[model samples]
Target: MDALTALHNRVSTGKLTEPAPTEQQRKNIFLAALRAADHACLRPWRFLLVEGEGRERLGGIFLKAAEQAEGAALTEAQRQRTKAMPLRAPLIIVAITRLQEHPKVPHLEQHMSTAGAVQAMLTAAYAEGIGAYWRTGPLAGNPLVAEGLGLANNERIAGFIYCGTPDKAPRQAPDLAVDEFFSYWGAH
Candidate 1:
């Protein structure tokens, strides 16, 4: 698909199935991510690719983290759901931001750069006929999850990007009005 078409039509695919993106598709996705704009060229982002047994292990880590956070209060259904979260897709990319003290760029901008990278990846996935979803919940911010994922103190989870085959055809992108979100501001 054309770049403009991909950018305008990309949408999150929540119902992903087996058969993850092909190696070439992944390359395109990652390359798009690497092109995200960054201040001072900090390159403050890193990613973890989880698939097959790694997804199971990630689910275990999530379960442990959730259990620690909620204790016995967690219902059986919740526990099972937590354990199966990672199984929703065939492959998962854990986006992380490495914080640094830059004279000009703050931590928030660094995180924004990572967000841009993930967005680019999502668009690229859409262009390649792959399903992709970016998700972040309580588990994403839990300290236990950070430790389990071997994230350092300066590294923070940005999102869990799930990629796979869509269960059905992708829905059309909503036609939003540019005027609704854009405006002219010269000397307001």
Candidate 2:
């Protein structure tokens, strides 16, 4: 698909199947992410590609986070479910952001840039006919999870990009009007 088409049609795929991008394809996806607009060239984004046994490791992080939060109240079944989340897709890309002290870029802008990286990755995956989804919850941002992932105190997981072949066709996008969310400033 062309860039414009991909931009308009890229929607989250919740039912991602197995067989995600190969190692080489993942490299290409990361390359696309690096090309996202970086204000002041802060380049504040980092990525952790979880696949194979790495996915299990990520799941363990989630389970550990749950355990730390709930302690004895955390059920064994819930812990198992946390570990199984990674298996839902063939791979998951953990998006991380590095805080900058003297950055000319604002924190919100840097966050948007990281989101733009996610967009780039999703677009690239769409171009390759791959299904992808961005997901996050309490576990993603938990300190225990961060520790399990070996991230610094200043780093955070923006979201997890689950990738695989389409388990089903994507839904058609709803018709949208620019006027609904757009505003003219100086002159229309």
What C-alpha lDDT values do all the predictions have? Answer: 0.95, 0.85
lDDT of 1 by residue, 47-161 (tens): 9999999999998999999998987578999989999999999999999999999999999999999999999999999999999999999988999999999999999999999
Worst 10 residues of 2 by lDDT: 98-107
Off by over 4 Å in 2: none
Best lDDT among the predictions, by candidate number = 1
lDDT of 2 by residue, 57-174 (tens): 8787777788788874767787788779988899889999887765477888888889999989988888777889999888878998888889997788899999999899888778
Instruction: For candidate 1, give the lDDT.
Output: 0.95
> Can you give the lDDT of residue 127 in candidate 2?
72
Question: Candidate 1: where is the Cα deviation over 4 Å?
Answer: none
Best model number under TM-score: 1
Error in Å for residue 84 of model 1? 0.2
Which pairs of residues collide in model 2? none
